[model samples]
Target: MISVYHYMTIAAILFAMGTYGVLTRKNAIVIFMCIELMLNSVNLTFIALSRHLNNMDGQIFVFFVMTVAAAEAAVGLALMISFFRNRESIDVEEIDLLKW
Candidate 1:
């Protein structure tokens, strides 16, 4: 049987990879994907705990997280599309929109 440690370790690795991608990637879409990866990693932890405790609370929380993730993906993709349309490029370094 798989232990909690195994699940947790997998979650940790996924979260780390997502973090690294967010920090190193310049494309907005890639960063968005990484954010989703991080969210999924958290969901994995929640599921692991839920199974270990034989409770529904963790699974319920995962449901909520999934809902939020869906909303975030929709809004993030729309924003990226709008930005790309205006800038004609999606490169993070060149598409600075905060300048005066």
Candidate 2:
């Protein structure tokens, strides 16, 4: 039986890696992937807690989060496509054009 602590540790590591990728990567796509990783880490934690507590609420919340993530990914990818068509590059720094 996997312990909750183990699940939490793995989640923490994954979230940390995602955070690092978001902070240090210059590519917009990579940052998006990192954000997905972070979301997945949270999902893992949710599922683990749901099982440990013998409750369906955490699992239900995870389902909602996944749904939102899918929607966000769709919209985000559409925006990325538009940005790429206009700029010809997916570098995060290049997006400074929107900076005030």
Candidate 2 weakest ten by summed lDDT: 91-100
Compare the candidates by TM-score and give the number of the best one. Answer: 2
- Candidate 2 C-alpha lDDT tens digits along 13-63: 999999999999999989999999999999999999999999999999999
List TM-score per model, in order: 0.93, 0.95
lDDT of 1 by residue, 1-100 (tens): 8899999999999999999999999998898889999999999999999999999999999999999999989998899889888898787898665899
Q: Give me the runs in candidate 2 sitting further than 4 Å from their true place.
A: none
Model 2: residue 83 alpha-carbon error in angstroms = 0.5
Error of 1 at 100 (Å): 8.6
- Assess candidate 1 and give its TM-score to the true structure: 0.93
Overall lDDT per candidate, in order of appearance? 0.94, 0.95
